[model samples]
Each structure stands twice: as structure tokens, then as C-alpha cells.
Target: MTTLEQLLDLPRFSDLEILSAHKNLERKVESVEITETPDVANFIPKNAIVLTTAMIYKDDQSKMKHLLDTLVSKDVAALGIKVGRFIDDIDQDVVDYASKVDVPIVKVPSSQPLGRLLYQMLSYIWDAKTEQLTYALDIQKRFSGLLMHDVNLSRFIAELGKIINAPVILLSPWHKVISNSQYFSRSDHPASFYIEQIDDHHYDKINEGNSSFIVKDLKGENVQVLGYPVNVDTYFPFHLIILKPEQIPYPVSEFAIEQAILVLTFILFKNYKVDEFFDIMKSDFLSQLIKAKTDQTHDHRNWVDLGSRYGLVHSKYYRLALAYCVPNKDNKTKLIYRQEEAAIAKKWLEAQLPLRIKNVIIFKVKNTNEIALLFQSQEPDANKVLQTLADELKEALSIQLCFAFGNPYEAITNISSSFIEAKSALDEATRLFNPNVVNYYHPKGLVGLFENTNEESIHYYCEKILKDLAYPNDQSQKELRNTLKHYLDYNCEITKTATALYLHRNTIKYRIKQCEKLLGLSVKDPENSLNLRLALELSESGNESSEQAEPGA
Candidate 1:
């Protein structure tokens, strides 16, 4: 608690004094006020010691009476009269009128300057304020440990508010109320209320270079509002601070407020660090789990945590996906900028998607130009999302993407299967169809037919089919390749193959005979024809180019 003696000791009031003559009268001074007009009575602040000179109505008795009437109406604490050159003697009429009105008038002599008296009063008020602030600071320091113990903001703010004898409210940058001390009447409002207050125009004032303080008069309220900018960082999406009384007689300890704000800022930052630590733990755990389940080696396959690569873990959902960029034409060049491209793709996706899609994770798989994403979604539209991602990659990166979407599995255990399916679908897309965009469920129709075919058998059959078509002449080789493709395609039916190839039935029969002679195989036998046809299909599909060498070459 601040004492009156402490208030008098403030340096700001070092030069002024309360007249002993007036002090001896045994009158109480409740509050302090400063004004210029003689009509001070009309606007005398409540419980205030009115400070003014009679210069405004030195000769007018009616004006003095009106002023006295106003002061009486306001229930002023006392009247302070500054008597300098303007009033050489205490006006008998004024003193008589004031006495009649029962308004105590303290004479301020010419020898004692009005400025010095005002300064003394101000100093006294400030000294008391400083003492109160010192007490608050002491309380804050003592309670610092409690604050550090993860106490909710409301409790902390309430304690601070009690010490200051003022209401305290916490607000985000958008003016959303977080918590309030006991003094505030209301504690809750619509979320949109806060959002509406955070206008872009105000950002400059709040987020300008470093820290700032401003006093504003809210249009509807008579209370003076002071705003303090909480300095975290440029990218800190939210700003937080407390609001309290603006200009009460209670001294504001700027230092105490600064220290309190610093402590709060530290708490917020610490929370962020803890969150980040947990997110990294979660991401690493998931990545390792997938890696273990797949038995992925360092060379052949690996999982990547996209969330960590691009700060996606800071978002509400921790999600990502993976896409592989396989080489064509037997080239082994690794995909360059796979991670960088994924980041770019992620940004593009963000632009295209609705603002509600706040969290997206992306990363590049090791040893492969495969981008992985852990998409975070509350309710996902998989097809639309996939198409959007594919379109963006195609348009911006110009790189065809094979998106392997994992199930929206909440746990690490189920993710591996989704990942495997996506990878299989991606591989099939690269091998049998366009690599631009493919989903795991897309090639379901072909899964049944190709399920039993081994990699080696498929390679061998494709090689043999191409080998039988290698003719001595380029034109004849082309002709034979076309003929074999049609014959195998038509299930070895001479009529259908001939018709499909736009040739006479005899011509097709002759080509088959020629093919049988060259390959030394029975083209008419079912078992032999199946082998030939399988080989033809693989060779035509271009998977056996390296194995199927040209004849005589």
C-alpha cells in the first residue's frame, strides 16, 4: 500500500507546498484536478481538489457565484486559489461567497508559484503511484514461481489485477478476449468479434518494427484504453497482452509492467518450444515406424517427414503424403530438387485450396526424387485434392507426379499399408500407364489379370516375343512386328488377326507361317501361342528393350 508521505516525497513535487494556514483548517483533500476556467464548479471532477486562479472572473460576483454553484454541484473536495499579480488581496466578496457556499478555498500565495504547486501535487500523486507499483513488482517476483508452474492465465491475471486495483483483460492481436481479471464485467464474446477488430490497417501500428504503446479512446466507451504490443516475432500469428486502467491517480510502474509482459512473453515462447519438440518427436516416431515396417534399406527405399521440412507440424494437423518420380528410358539420374520441388508444390496447393486447409506436410524420400506429403485434414476430399495437386505439379513444376496417398490413418501402424499400396500404384503407373497422376485404387481392374505374373517371367516373355519379330530388313521387321501384335492380340485367330491388321486372311496365315519358321515355334498350339502372346505384349509395351537385342547386331 502507498502512503501519503511517500506521495509527498516524489521529486516531481519537490518545490511545492500546501499552505499551513489551510492545512490547519482540518479539511480533507480527496482527489486532485487541474483546470483553467472559473466555471470549474460546473465541471469539478468527483472527489477532487480543484486547482485554479480567479483570473477568469476576478471582478464578476455572478460568475464567481455560478462557479461556486457548479463546484457545490460536483461535491468538490476543496478549492485551491492561485493568488499572484492578478489578485493582490483575497477578494472579500469571493471569500464571503465561498464561505456562504461552504466551499473550502485554500489560498495559494504569489510568493509560492502556481506551477511549483501543481508540480508538487503531481509529484505527490506520482510518488504514491510509484510505491504502489513497487509493491506490485514485489508481488510479481514472489509469485513468479507460481506463474512459471503452468497456471492458467486467468488466475495469474486476476492476482495481478488485484494488486493494481484495476481490471485486467488479455487480448490477442485480433482483440479476442482470452482471460480477464475480476474487475471486468463480462468475460466472453463471439470469436468473430475479435477477428473483426484485427483489421489489416491496424497491423502496421501493432506489428511495426519492434514494440509500441498507444492510448486510444474507444468510440463507445468513456474509459481510456491503453494498448501494448507484445513482441514475439514477425511470424508469430497471434499477439497477446493485458489491458488495464489508463490514467487513474494510481501510479503506473512502467518497469513493473515491462517485467510482467516479458515474463508472459517468455511463457508463450516456452509453450511454443515445447509444442515444437513434441511435434518433432511425433514426426520422427512415425517416420521410423514406417521405415521399420517396410524394412526399408538406406539404398532402395526410405520414408521422409514432410511436416518437419516445412514447419507443417506447427499447424493443427500433422499430415503429409509421398510421391515418386521414376526415371524413364533406363536412365538412373536421380530427381534433383525433390525436396525443394515438394515445398514449391505445397505452396501451390495452399494457394489453390481453401483457407481452411491450414496444415500440410511435405518432404522428399531419400535416394529417390519422390516427394511425400502428410496431408492434415479434418474432412478430406481425396479426389479433388489429388487432382489439384497433380494439376499444380503439371502446370508449375512441369514434372509428372505419381501421387501415392496414404489412408487418413491417425496412428503410425496403419500408415505403412497405405504407403505400400500407394507406392505399388505409383510403380504400376510408371510401368503400364502415364506417370502424370495415379492413385492406388485406379488400376484395380488390371490387378486380377496381372496378379500371377512374376517379374522374371514377364521380362522373359516380352524379350522372346520381340526376338521373333526381328527381321533382316527394317520395313519387313516393322511389318512382322505389326503382324505378330495383331495375331497375338486376336487370340491366334487368323480371320480376326487379318481383319484387324487390314490384310487378307491368307496374308495373315502366311505371316504366321513365316513367324513360326523364323522363331522355330508352333504358332497354332495354345501353350506355345500363350507364351508368344505374353512376350509380344511385354515387348510391345517397351519393358524388354534392353533384353531384346536386334538380330545380327
Candidate 2:
């Protein structure tokens, strides 16, 4: 860290004068060399100050110019000449050339020996190096002590910020804030400003290159951010970042950030593995509970014992719900069901659920895009809690989720019945083309009534009841069929039907009249309306089944 300007201030070299290139005195001097040979430039080290008498170039001004040019090309820090010895004074041409090229030239008097000057410069360098080494070792000890203690992730980040004297942030793969230091709150801008300024595209390049890089003044402020990737061997790893002010001339030490990344990688990876281990255990427990036989040989008490670990208790009413990822408008099915996102979704659900519904177990189904939940149904507000959870998850996941829950049962052995009912409700909702909504299993609903009926018989009954609407031949007939279906779904309320279908009330009345004319029956009659609703539902269900049963479906 010794500069040529600082060397001039030494006690032994206080009389040295700068002959040229005054602005270049700030260049660093890492070492010093004493050489009088003509070709010293070929072997002199870089960032070094060369001490010479200029005896070889005293007779030729061009040779002196060549020497200065060669020294500049080799990145020599400075040149000190022994004045009033072999050369009384430097040539004007040589001084001008050195100054023009920004090469520092120092004049040394005859009383000052080149050997003593070299010694002084090297001693300064050694002292600087020693100080740097001590600083690095201190940083190592402090950061290393963090691991010896059982500190959480937030505490670790806070300590890291204290060591570096800058704001630190730990980010997930999606650029969400996993944790941040207290210094972040004292910044001129909020955490969201920096998070938004994080260039994902730049991070992608850094990730691909597998190196640490800096981004200058992210939002046109005097702040530079350093992004260091942790656990690069994994599929998606966390990014450790530091925000430093621009007034600080030098960046934070590389050894400091490296030590932080090392300890943080260990902490984060350990937590991830622990979470993964518990997920496997929970999944196995649920699998065993659902697949267990309720025969006389198998004791039901053992089931309750195993379920107790996951908040499932004996004699508690529980409902089984199954959720599936529904396709979005952009056809993001390919991005859905990734193991990482599913894990995140599970954590979000666990943290966001209401405290009243505490006895809940959730796990991702094996080899499928489904999540299974088994929770107690003791509270009257449990349904409302589930609906709120579903809405939040759907928005948070950036994809649609359809949930179907079966009726509650008190016995652990009856979990299999609940699972079956949930599956049946999901399948029925899918057939009705309304699979994105939350569905509850009702044993006396229309779907449950016709669950065991033959597909051909259902199709025949549907066609017999609604003659032409069953298979529309034109757009007008299609609109009439859709309007009639919505009318019945809204309980024949013209206002609700219009709002649901986004149509005028008069249009709905006209469609109902047209349907009455075509079917030769009064839709206002209770029996006729009931039959029409049944036929419409059965027709839609049969068509959906037929399409799915096709070869390419």
C-alpha cells in the first residue's frame, strides 16, 4: 500500500525532488531495484521503482528517451537518478518525454546512495504487507468464530455486516429477501429499491461464469453492490450481497467476503438438508397411514401414535384435501411442479395458515403434481381459513391450484374413505370444466348421484332431454345452451345469471324464451327446470369424458 508520494516523505529521503510527472507520484511502489545495465527494462519487476546513475545513456539523448519509454511500457512505478555524479543534470528532451508519458522521475543527490534508497523503499513495502496480513488474519478469526456458536441465519448476517461495515442481504433464487442486516434499514432507500435494482440478467451472467462481480451505483446512487454466489454446485443457490458507499476508495477485502460465504454456505445447506429430511419422514408417515389396512390384525392405536408426531391426534375430526396445479394463460405447465417451487409453496402455506387450524399435515404427493393435506376440522371457521389459504397460494405460486376436500371423519381408519371422496370430487370438477375453483365433497350432489351410472346411458339421457342444445349446430344455439346452463346454475335469477354470463338482463330473458320454444316445455315449471339442469350437467360431463378418452388427449 506504499505509494511513491509517501516514499518522498520518509526521513532519509526528505531532500528528494520530483523532476517530472508530478501527477504520477500517487502510483504504488511494491518493490525497488538498483540497475545500471542498458537492458534493465527486460527483467525489472512491475510496480517497481528503478534507481540508476544514467551513466549508460549520458552520451545519447535518444537512448535516454528509449529507456524512459521502455520503463513506462513495463509499468515501472518511478525512476530515481543520481544527480551531480556521472550526469550533472538530465537533458531537457528526456525530462519532457518522461513527463509527457506520465512516468515519475526523481532526482537523487550525490550524498544519497542508490543502495540506501532501495533499502528504505523495501522496508516500507514490508511494513505495509505485514499490516495487511494482520488485518486478514483478524477477519478470519472473527468470521470463523460465528460457526463455532449456534447462530441462526439472521444473526449470522448481522455479524457479517458488522465485520464489513456495510449492509448485507441474503437472497433466495427468486430474488426474494431471505434475510437482511440491520444496516439495510438505515439506508436512504428501502430494501425493495435495492431488490428491484438487482439485475437478474446480470446475475444470470455471473452465475453462468461462476465468479464474483460488482455492479456500480445501482439506481444512480453512490452505492456499489457486490454479488457473490454461494453453493454454486447446487441447482439454485443463495446470493450474498454487500452494499458499500462510493466514498470508500477500496472495495471490502476479498478474504472477508470469502470467509462469510463459506460459513453461510454451511449454515444454509445444513438447514436445507434438515428440512428435506423431515419432508421425507412426513411423506412416509402419510403414505403409511393412507395405505394401512383396517383389519382385525392391525391395531388402530399404532396409527394414532405415528400420527401424533405431525400434530394428528386420536378422536379428532380430520378432512383430506388434494390439490393439483392448473394450467395458466401462458401455458406455464412446463415451469410448474418444479421440486424447488413446490417446497417453497409448502413452506408458504405452513406459515400463512391461521393459528386456530393448528393440527395440519401437508406433503407433496410422489411422482405427481399434487399436494395432500390432512388437517383437523374442529373449528367452525376452518372452511374460511382454507379458502383464504387457497387464494393466497394461487397468487403467490403464479399458477392456479384446485383443491377438493372430503367430509370430516373422526377415526384414523376412515382416512382412506376421505381420500377417495376427495379424488372423486376432483375428477368430477375436472369433467365440469370448472377445476380451478375450490370444491367440497357433498354426497347428495348431482355428481355423487350419477357416479356409478354408465357413460353411454348418461349420454343418451342427456340427448333425449335437450334435443338440439345437446349438440349445437350454430353459434346462436351454442349461446342459448350456455345461457340456459348459467340460468339454472344461478337458480333461475335473471340478475345473477346476467352478471355471471356478462350479458344484459333482457338478453338472458330472450335466451330463456328461445330455449322454451325449442324444447317445447315451460322452463318456469319446477319439474321441467330440474330436468333441464340435470340434462345440461350430464351432457357437459359426458363430452369432457369422451374428449379425454381419445387417443391423443
What is candidate 1's CA lDDT for residue 265? 68
TM-scores of all predicted structures:
0.44, 0.50
Instruction: Judge candidate 2 at residue 347 and give its lDDT.
Output: 62
Candidate 1 local lDDT, residue 64: 67
lDDT of 1 by residue, 1-553 (tens): 2333343455754443443222223233445777778665565456567777777666664566677678877766566777766666566766777777776666666676666676666665566566867865786685577566877667767766765565555654334566666755553443233334444445455555323343323344333334455654333223443343443234446556656666666665676577446645655655665666546453332233443454433323333456654334433343334443443444344445444344554444444446566565554565566676566556433545566555456543445665665666666666764554646434454334565588676666555654646322365656666777677777778887765666777777777787778788787788877767656654455422322322320
Backbone clashes in candidate 2 total 0
Q: lDDT tens digits, residues 212-242, model 2?
A: 3454344564556767788633445577777
- Compared with the true structure, all predictions reach lDDT values of 0.56, 0.73
**Candidate 1's TM-score:** 0.44
Question: Which prediction has the highest lDDT against the true structure?
Answer: 2
